[model samples]
Target: MNRVVVVGASAGGLSAAEALRRAGHEGTITLVGDEPQTPYDRPPLSKQLLGGDWEPDRLALRSGPDLDALALELRLGVPATALDPAARSVTLADGVRLEYDALVVATGVRARRLPGTDGVAGVHTLRTLQDALALRARLRAGRRLVVVGGGFLGTEVAAVARGLGVEVTLVEPAPVPLAPAIGEQAGRFLTRLHQENGVRVRVETAVGEVLSAEGAVTGVRLTDASVLPADEVLVAIGCVPNTEWLADSGLTVRDGLFCDEYCGAAPGVYGVGDVARWYNPLFGTDMRVEHRTNASEQAMAVARTLVGPGERRPFAPVPYFWSDQYGTRFQAYGHLRGHDEARVLDSDFAGRRLLVAYRTGDRIAGVLAAGVAPRPLRALRALVAARTPWEAALADPNAG
Candidate 1:
């Protein structure tokens, strides 16, 4: 490929651009970003940044000299408006069209917002740096904050607000937080974690509407007709992949940009990170991972495929993700979602330590642990990566 155009300026996009240079792609590299600022780490936006523990500058993925070393043509503040795969051209919002021999779609995803929340002050979604700053400004010692959605993002924000002395009320539509993703046992543990940290946990209820006054959020009305008066509200329901630009680009755009095992969407076009729901050979399924680790790893895989001197290799990886709440960390390896069975391998509720293994059919599909030693967790991760049989994994002495 003589020229490469990578759309999106987030972790995955930046990684792909850097990896291309590292892989000896001495061609024209254009990194297009919708946001004006240079790429910044996103995981910290919800934790350290929103908690006022870290400044914006700390989130920078690369410094001036570091980014300069890559010799990238940075195109910031202009969003890709459309894509023409046959022409191999990307049209930006500024009317600038970039043509490339190879293209990488890494636009990632945008946080889903609650209906009728537009233009409402005191309402927030933690997706970007600016979103974190705005929400941080409203989080005060005596402020009341209601968090809709008890997923990883919502729970983390609730924990941070509680630590800042903000009264937090967490509402979830599930019987327990993270039950659908992680099993009910593990989800209940997280529920206790939030409740113990002074967060009011409301389960099995959805938000009817966001109440507003004078063009600002005053509270939220729940499906039960109950109102939660709050100084701030964060809707951490979920995210939607940024695939609108590729609507008519002749690529399969289902939940995300559909890709093959090699991460190829079209002939010379590939997708990575949250925007790509590619097939994973490891688990024999298709998944789009939104974790920080997967972004860099998958981008590196695509880089190899793009500038390879040999045959193309499939981008297969054992997906991993973690969440930090109230000084405790929860880590999971492999595919935890859609597991048929979940068994608690180890537990110490009073000590706040637990290890759970999720099984899909007869194989150990995933593992989740908190307060467990790193050594044992690594061993469990190996089992999941190897797709160990359910009974065999349980028989192993180090399984716990």
Candidate 2:
């Protein structure tokens, strides 16, 4: 427990590193990241920072001096290429090998690119600070922005584009945006919301190829042979877990690196955040949460497991995520997937109300509301933790 190493520059990786040091490891701590710059906050990159309303420094969760003050050996700009479980060592991209007593894999994920869109200029994805910078510069007024995929990122970017006075068209292959997680009813309502706010939404519209003119994006040609003109295109299709570097490694990796409840992958190696898949006894499944809360909780768990455990907290933190669209703050608690029914606890969907979600044959599963007070959300977290029955929670005791 003297020395610990964490890999990844994403939220989970950074959180894990900071948690280990703050918990008084009193030993050598190293943070290795693949991305060149120091670890920066990502969620804001899609909202405030990319929207040109916030400075780049505002996107940083912690600064360089902060890492030094915490006494961490931050190996920034280096990515781990391989893992040796038997020898307890990691191979960096620069052919340097480092050994550690314990390791935490928080390598997060990378955005999936369009097959033929790479050579096309003006096509972009917003997963990193660099990507945001490039896209922000292109957010000029009168520009026609076509956002591929109607997921959270695409929708959020559309909102920003519209706000910047750019003509935006969102192309989604799904029947509706967020229909997979939030249900079709909710997704339909959201679609209307977007259209009302000046975003042109196209459902079940697949982009066959990103049209290019002189090596730069001109528009997108849909599967139906219709061509939609655009000056810039944002691809927010999805993300891939950064577990490829461990292909030859001993640890098992499916969608993400598999780990136990303690965030430990092997005896000493741990995994967290978007690159981790851990069993949640509460949910009776292997949960791989991709939220800032997961990063903080998993890092704390990994830190406790590495250092001597005095008193520890469980890894059963209720997952939480938030999104900003059209100047409204949206928040969610608990897992949204695997839910059978959604109950309107105390929400006026027309005017930003709290919506409580429940799982089939069980208790509350998730929550969604517009601008709810922080206090009630905490109570809902308690209810979700206690596995509170939905029927009683439906009465809306202190609606959030």
Candidate 3:
């Protein structure tokens, strides 16, 4: 392709752009994003970014010198209003048009906003650096923080807020924080952890409305007619794909832009990051992973596919993700779906290290653990590539 356009990128688009430039693609490459800032590591937004490290070097995905070297055309802070696959161009919100021979849609997902809380001030969602910056300023001692969801973002924000000595209350409709991802057995582990940390975690709680006065939030009203006081309420319930613009682009969008095994959306179009729902043969599921790793992996693969046929491998990488909370670093490798069993080979919640192995009917499917044990992620790609059996992984001391 002589000209390539990439849109809606957070984690993967940056890598895909670099990989394209690195692979000697001597063509006009345009990277477009709605967010003003360059792509940085989002996993840090809730962690270190909240801790107040907003330096350019730390948050910048591509440095000025690199951008100068590549001279890649960038249309930052401009959102694509419409995409036309037939016309081979995109219409920007500013009414400008961008034409390309190939298009990589990397628009990542956005945090879903609560309906009743639209007018509620001090209520926020953490997705971009600006969100983290604003939230960080609000996290001070004596501030009553009502976290509206017990998902990863909410839990992480709660952890950080509590560390800053803020009063944190977490509300979740589910019984535990991560019941949707991990089973009840593992979710209880977090419930106890939150409680032990002096965080008030409310389960089976439904928010009917958010109370506000003077154009600012004050508290939340539960469906049970109880009103909880809060200085700020953060909604981390869920995320929606940034694919609403592609509704007319003719690409299949189911929750996210659905793609084939190679992250290919259409003939000359593809998607990466949180926006792409690619089929995973290993899990036998169509996964739309919002993790940082998926963005980078799928983007690199897509970039290669656009470049040449150097290697034709299905876009299947061992799914891995990590989160740090309450001083413990949680990591996971492989798809933890339909796991017949999960055995705790080792655990020291107090020591901040634990190992949990997931098996799919006698075959090891995934592993979640704490600490810097990288073996699971290192060999996981090969294992998934080869469809390796779990007997050998279970026999290995590090994995089991």
Candidate 4:
């Protein structure tokens, strides 16, 4: 392979570029992205960036010298329009076509906007640096805010807004927020955490419509016919994989770019980050993870397969993710769903240091905990990965 083309400029894409050089692939490298600016970290966008503690430069994933040293032909601020696997070429929006020996698609995802919310002032979704900056401007003290959806993004945004002294009302249609990811018990705990932090938690409720007047958001009408007035509204339903550009690309795409265990989308084309959905033999499912760790790990894996000589190991990862909300850090590993049993390890609910272990049949399936030490977290992750017996994991003192 003499030339490599990496689409997307976020964490996964940039990491792939660096990984290529590390693997001794001294060939023409092109890093393309739709965003105008250089690659930057996104996790902090919802936390410190919105909290006003971190500057824009702190989010820089790579310095100019660092990027220049890689000799990457950067095509920023423009998106890829189409892909031709037969020709091994990518078409950009400007009609320019670039051929490559290997292609890495890391386009990631975009925040899903709610219906009847577009073109309305004071309505927002945080996905990019620009989105964060715009939303941060409205996270003022004494302002009334309504955050729709109770997923991580919505919950985190509500947490930040509450810390900023903004009166926040978080609405979720589900019985509990984050129930799909962390289980109903943990979800209810998170709901209570938000309430204790002065955020009005509305569960089993949906946003019927976004009430607006004079082209600005006025409030939100709930499914129960109750209205919560708001100065600004944040739509945090979730995100959609950015794979529309690959519609006719001949690669299988279902919600995300479908790839094999080696992250191979086609013969020479690969996928990574949020846009890639690959089967995980470990988890027994095909997952498209949007976490930062997955992006970084998968990018390196794909790069090695493209440049480094080796037997291609399947990309089977023990899924992990963390969230920081209102001074509490919540972390989880493994698949929390399909577990038949959940057992508590530590029972200090008042101190907010709680730990829970999930079991599928006799084997441990997952772990969810807050305010726990790294030692226990690591042990839990190991146990889940190894599919350790439930009794052995429960008896491990460090697991608490």
C-alpha lDDT score of every prediction, in listed order: 0.92, 0.81, 0.81, 0.90
TM-score against native, each model: 0.99, 0.95, 0.93, 0.97
1-400: candidate 3 lDDT, tens digit per residue:
8999988646788888888988779999888989877667788888888866454359777778877777678889999989999889999889999999998998888898988666667988998888888888888999999998888788888988988999999999987678657556566777777789989988898788988999899899988788889998888988999888888888899999999988888878888888899987776668888898888888888888889766856787778887788888778777775677777766666766667767676566777777636765455445544556777766664453
True lDDT of residue 147, candidate 2: 93
Candidate 3: stretches off by over 4 Å: 53-57, 337-340, 360-362, 372-398
Task: Please identify model 1 stretches exceeding 4 Å from their true place.
Answer: none
TM-score of model 4 (CA atoms): 0.97
Instruction: Report model 2's TM-score to 2 decimal places.
Output: 0.95
Q: Can you write out model 1's per-residue Cα lDDT over 27-123, one digit (the tens) per residue? A: 9889999999999999999999988889999999999999999889999999999999999999999899999999999999999999889999999
**Which residue pairs clash in candidate 2?**
none
lDDT of 1 at 223: 97
Note the clash tally of each candidate.
0, 0, 2, 0
TM-score of 3: 0.93
Q: Considering TM-score, which of the candidate structures 1 and 3 is the better prediction for this target?
A: 1
lDDT of 4 by residue, 173-281 (tens): 8988988777777887888889988999998989999999999999999999999999999999989999999988778999999999999989889898999999987
Encode model 2's per-residue lDDT on 145-176: one tens digit a residue: 99999988899999988999999999988888
RMSD of each: 0.8, 1.8, 2.2, 1.3
